[model samples]
Target chain A: MNDLVENVVKGDIRAVARLIRDIDDGIPGVREALKALYPHTGKAYVLGITGSPGVGKSTLVDQMVSHLRRKEKTVGVLAVDPTSPFSGGAILGDRVRMQRHSLDEGVFIRSMATRGHFGGLTQSTRSAIDVLDAMGKDYIIVETVGVGQDEVDVVKSAHTTVIVVIPGMGDDIQAIKAGILEVGDIFVINKADREGSDKTLSDLRLMIDMDQKKYEDGGWKPPIVKAQAVFDKGVEEVLEEVEKHRAYLLETQGEIDFRRSPKRVREELMDLVKNRVIEEVLGKLTETGDFDAAVEAIARGEKDPYSACDELVLPRLEIH
Target chain B: MTGKRRIRIMVAKPGLDGHDRGARIIARAYRDAGYEVVYTGLHQTPEEIVEAAIQEDVDMIGLSSLAGAHNYLFPRTVELLKEKGADDIVVCGGGIIPDEDIPTLKAAGIREIFTPGTPLDVIVKWVADNVEPRGEY
Candidate 1:
């Protein structure tokens, strides 16, 4: 499976997509791929790009990828989409936004959905990142779903987070409610040509200045830059600034993604525990072969879920 | 996309789309009609949606994009969803779709197209009518 996924990591898009599916299904093949790729992880400079919907995040990411490629840096993008609550299906289309990067041999673009992982990247995301890292991608960008607070939770895994905003609409309190301002390492005022760009930019800068440093090491003070991404104006400067920040982090090593250590450990442990428990429970469920009976009882109100849990699950755990 | 219990939907914004008034209203409609809702903030792309759906085992996808790239983004997403072996999953589109473009979308095999200002109840019933749940509520 790792061999298959290794091929995937090395420009085999079809194999890669299959590997992603395997990961989604929690299949054995994905487990092999992940275990094999773990050692090759952590090379890429993880970047988190987030903003309001109309702020042109996709367009900006396109520009950034283009600029990075010009610098000969290999890249991978994890774009998140929204799924309907009524149906757990999603259309992963973030790749369509990066027309140029999609064709680049040095780039890997994977669109992911929240799949309602409780506001975090899926277990497969970490594996996918590992594959991309082993394939030598210098930058890995995770574009999280804009599910308010969960957005922050997802991006916290990245080394640097860029929170993008645009002018106009709503009150100052609303801006704060978005929860982006606090998480941003860099603030982008996209659509700078629009009305009130100056005001938005100024207000953001002031807010940053007013907020106290939460980190003792005087973590990076976010710099706000105004640009219109639609016309490609000011994109170059944004890229340069992004580069500057990347270099700064590299030179300073200001933080080792202070968040990754705990996130990784917790996730690995939980995934292990979850698999063991589910395997035990399912083994019991299947051994009894009372699938139809259980269903009928649950459906007929002969057994509520609470009692079913006690009868079916608790006893299984007790024996284990 | 088949489930016995109602499929829970999560409308996420993967980036900085601050205008989620539409996504939220739609979520409310789905919830009132007996569905679980997982609303990801704003500015989400296709990947986030897929990841959430796989985890939630959703039966359908609904995204609102008035941002002009719907033609490019939406169809590409549908293709990717198919690649995921979720071809049976109904993919729907909404938000500012032009009258003329509706047919093109239908031709693309989108489950249904619901434009802006459509009734929330209609959208709820439409989803219920189109997709089957796999879980027991």
Candidate 2:
């Protein structure tokens, strides 16, 4: 175990990849590996890229990775794709876009499957980010499974989230007006060479202007860049905007702790605790057949659900 | 892990192979078989395929070549995996290959070869029966 941790910390690509796989598979005892890796994290700048499918999130990420690599930064990429609910399988084809960096020792790209998890990312994605961070990646780019409205979980993990959209999304632009639009630190209008780009750009500008009061109050105003990722146009400007956002965060916060604010840390801790407690309690109930009996009793109308809940949980809880 | 561990496979079209219909079909088959398959797209080099397979921590690499470059591409991929000390990742090949070349390819550490018209289930089952997740947790 120590050797595995040591190898990962040493930035051994094989060790890092294996640890991430184990984490994703929910292998027992991998938590010890994560515990060891945690101290080594908080070094990599995490960037989240998300948008609707076919909007060129992967192409944009591929371009950004090339730019970052040219600046001599080591990068780790976790590109996620959705799993098949029916077969519990997935075709992780995002690596197809970023294959140019496959042989580069400085870049490690891992494609992840959502594995039945909602919100555009798998449960293990957070830990996988930590694994790459621990492996000494200068930047870790997490591209979410081409997201729609409400798949905004990437914002929780990224220091700066880049939301990519193409021209002519039509009603899709209105659909994103709710959840995903609010979380972007940077917005990209990729495939800007296509028709209807101006309308999309203007629509986004109008939306940003509508929130002008928030920026007037000295909050960071998200910058939108028009890009043709396939043609490699506007990529540098997008990267520049990302750098500007990072600088703003650093200037405001004094020190950027790899994008995790105190609030995010608190939320992460609470989530972990909640998950652990649920797993333990549910495991115990199912093991003792209490859960099944409660369900059967409820179905038979022998007890109301509220009292049944108290009957099952109230005893388990020690009251003051 | 308490539950069944998911197998990951890289279905790569190495060496300028524009014919990827077979590759895509096999990738879909692998996915349907409950394996997380990374399809690296067309025109990948042997080095790229091996590096991707390792970085993904995949259990196997299903090398698909139809451009008559399998003799070099398949063996090169296998050799690169060995060179990178990732030889534990099982390697297999499919696509246009002569019967005479199969023994040499197998000798070069290609695990199994499936010719054209082989059933998809057969390949999936071969993978399920032969490949376990590589390395200890």
Candidate 3:
């Protein structure tokens, strides 16, 4: 397995990218690669910044990167957007706003699109993060776009989750209460310069207070911070709170453990295993000419998808 | 299919950018082009995306980010993918990419940049030509 990518670290851009390509394609020799780099998986503190559209998550990330650079910590930011099917491209308009941190040696930024995979849930992403960790990035920030309540699901793997909010978005607190509130490690009310900032903060406080009863974890609670991301206001405070949360996790291992329960592990494991099995079975099914027949049957309503999936599909994927 | 290992691809979307039209199209293109495409639904964390790559045993991850969230999502994907020892996967990017960020994207370990107006043949050819699926032996 002496491929060009073995024993490669992440200091350079092309090397890391090539490695990602190889891994993303599910080439055979990747187990050896991860086995070689297993020790570096948990070093980087992962920060997930998410909010409704127009909350200025990017501007906030810019400010955070600036602050991180001041402390001399290497930062890697991952921004995800959508691509055009016709053109196979992205505007990446967000990156255009954060050019200030692009040239900094310690800061690296990249924009990714789902590029027509079922969703942007690519395994290459996991490997990419490891590469950055192995490269010694102290902070890794992933800014995700909100897709209603389900958007919060991605943050489950994050070490720290910052839910960004705008001031005048009418019921910003309500949205938080609806979905993002419970997921927040720390809540950030961005665009604090706007009017109604107090109402938003107060409403958020009230919401947090309501959840106070459900939260039981050595008294761990998500804090709220206000910031005008355009001006980089309170960005440092936000970062500090993120650090505080990370430090809190380190100091209070009991909390992180409880949050990352067995159920969480099982769900992630199932997802991983399910996808892999489906790939193998799907390839076989297609190769054996059952795929199109199954599809046509489903399309023609000759059979139920569940039965088809369980019998023709699941049987093959069964480890037994 | 020849002696080459099938190209494994994890097609993922990182944020609330739920516009899956492009991501879906490319996933099909990759599939039709004879690559194994893994599609994780919208609003995936970078870590989740990376986890999918590792568990699925993929060789390349194609991410489609449309809501201007790529900067935060792509590098995070890169960082996690590398950490997990699947760094040999070529990370190719496609979306409404601005010309200015091309160098930055490349610098962030993007193997190849797929911009708007890129033909499907080009994308199909690029993956077929570049990515080699692991362990065909």
Best by lDDT: 2
Question: DockQ for each of the predicted structures, in order?
Answer: 0.05, 0.68, 0.05
Ranking by DockQ: 2, 3, 1
Candidate 1, residues A222-246: lDDT per residue as tens digits? Answer: 7887877767777777766767777
Q: Give the alpha carbon lDDT tens digit for every residue of A247-271 in model 3.
A: 7876866444322557656755665
Off by over 4 Å in 2: A117-123, A148-150, A258-260, A285-320, B1-4
Indicate the residue-level lDDT of A16 in model 1: 56
lDDT scores of the candidates, listed in order = 0.66, 0.86, 0.69
Which of 2 and 3 is ahead in TM-score?
2
Ranking by TM-score: 2, 3, 1
Backbone steric clashes in candidate 1, count: 64
Provide chain B TM-scores across all predictions.
0.84, 0.95, 0.91
Candidates in order, interface RMSD in Å: 10.0, 1.7, 11.7
Error of 2 at A41 (Å): 1.1
Q: Give the TM-score (vs. native) of candidate 1.
A: 0.61
Could you give candidate 2's per-residue lDDT for residues B101-133 as a string of tens digits? 999999999999999889889998999899987
Question: Each candidate's fnat, in order?
Answer: 0.00, 0.77, 0.02
